[model samples]
Target: MDNRTNLDDYLAELGISEADESVTPPPMPDASDSAPVQEAADTDARGTLERFLRGLIARIDPELSVTVREVDDALEAEISGENAARLAGRDGRTLGAIEVIAYTVLSKQEGRGDTRVRVDIGGFRKRQADTLSKLAERLAIGVAKSGEPHELQPMPAAERRVIHIALKEHPDVMSESVGEGASRRLVIKPRHG
Candidate 1:
């Protein structure tokens, strides 16, 4: 018999799954069908991403023993392992803020383009996404069970999008993004209205 496990367990562990397999994958993309599109997007996204990142570092912790590095197919800038936690902020809030700012700035600088880019400062956003995904799922379940709406703290539109997408699968709950501009937040509520 093939090894089998619950789908939720699979998603929790691997962040994704195959239709017929029990194997768990790491929390990165599969890079199969959309490789070319992804590759092209990243190629187009990198130059602006790097310029934004370098400028951010120069302004923030200029003497923190850290530096920004660029790659061809990267939509986000990475720093050497030497400096992660400090730049990452508490659970990546600071990093997320930086990324949002860069995305907004670069997208505007390039003439109001909705460029699809992800900014990862030292992998902080990566880890935070995984962690927040699970947290959002659980919190959604709780909100559904209690039939009470939950208002999350303010976060960027991107992060609110992250949580909104993560909890989309559960039919018992729904999410709405409210507030305006930088102070926006996601509110979870029972689906029945």
Candidate 2:
């Protein structure tokens, strides 16, 4: 009926039980204790998220496992095991959905909304980044030699970012995103002096 109930139902379907909501409030602390309190909150949030992800993945496939770690001020959850590839889905749509849901749930918590979450299944994101990086390199070379711009197929913003980062410091080429929304694409162009 209510949003909380709906969220609980959704999480239940995903195999994550509703967390106990009966937490006792902590006493006010002095300024000197603020840093430790914040650090403890961060650790608690990370542990909660890790447990949630592990439960969700286990529901999908009992054999799957998730490892969560902090990377660049964000939480990265890597799912592995026999069903990892299948869970990633075609073009990683499933993985993307999982990441979105995970973040949404995490943000709903009182103090965890600012935490950033990244979910990668079976190294899918890593492999895709490597491929995109290599493609950017090859295209930059061609564009430099031909003095023409090469446009890439439409892709999600994240993928486009990969291409941009790949060519960020290229001596003879530059990358840009053109178009809008779902039709947006990356273009590699020669950088003339």
Candidate 3:
């Protein structure tokens, strides 16, 4: 009886294959250099973020890779490999949770002000933003043409911000958020003539 768990088989069951390049190649770490790597990570925000994301990824698949980079005022972490989508969850709830936790911990350690943290799995955030922007544009157009208010499905605060930003400069429509908590929605209204 073979008891060894095959990661490839498990990944395949999860709809991932060995041929997928989302998984990053592990670095060839020297036996003597591992401790220094850990030490160095504690000294920098970038390294700290990488370590945090790697820790989260390890919980799902020990072999999956996480990369963190400083992007503008935020620390962007990318999780690659088979289990990325699972970590991202439906509508990116899981990913958002992870980012919030990481950001909270990081802020506590370094003191909070600016520099937000974002997590992305397979460009999910970027794709979501693009989708939201396009939807906002279409809804704004509808509101402008019909002079009727267009209400979008309830979404998270971050998503609402995307819609607001997208329609902020529209000449014929204005975007606003209504409702509370999870039920909060984006509404586009025809600008008063």
Give TM-scores for every candidate, taking all chains together and pairing residue i with residue i: 0.55, 0.78, 0.68
RMSD of each: 17.5, 6.1, 9.4
Q: What lDDT tens digits, residue by residue, belong to model 1 across residues 1-193?
A: 2122233332345565333333232232233535586554454345445544543454445543333334443244565345656887886777667666666655654432455455566667677778889888989889978999999999877678788888787788889998898778899998883
User: lDDT of all predictions, in order shown?
Assistant: 0.61, 0.78, 0.71
User: lDDT per residue, candidate 3, 1-193, as tens digits?
Assistant: 2221233433465585553445443332333544565344333556556655664566468767888877677778888887566668897878887788678656654454365888888778889999989988888878888999988899888899998999888899998899998899988999987
Which rank order by lDDT, best down to worst? Answer: 2, 3, 1
lDDT of 2 by residue, 26-139 (tens): 222233544577676666556656766765765567698888887777889999997688899988999998898888767775356678899999999999999999999999
Residue 37 alpha-carbon offset, candidate 3, angstroms: 21
Best candidate, lDDT: 2
Q: lDDT score, residue 63, model 1?
A: 45
Clashing pairs in 3: none
Candidate 2 local lDDT, residue 71:
75
Candidate 1 matches the true fold with a TM-score of 0.55
Could you tell me which 10 consecutive residues in candidate 2 have the lowest summed lDDT?
Answer: 20-29
The C-alpha stretches of model 2 lying farther than 4 A from their native spots are 1-8, 12-35
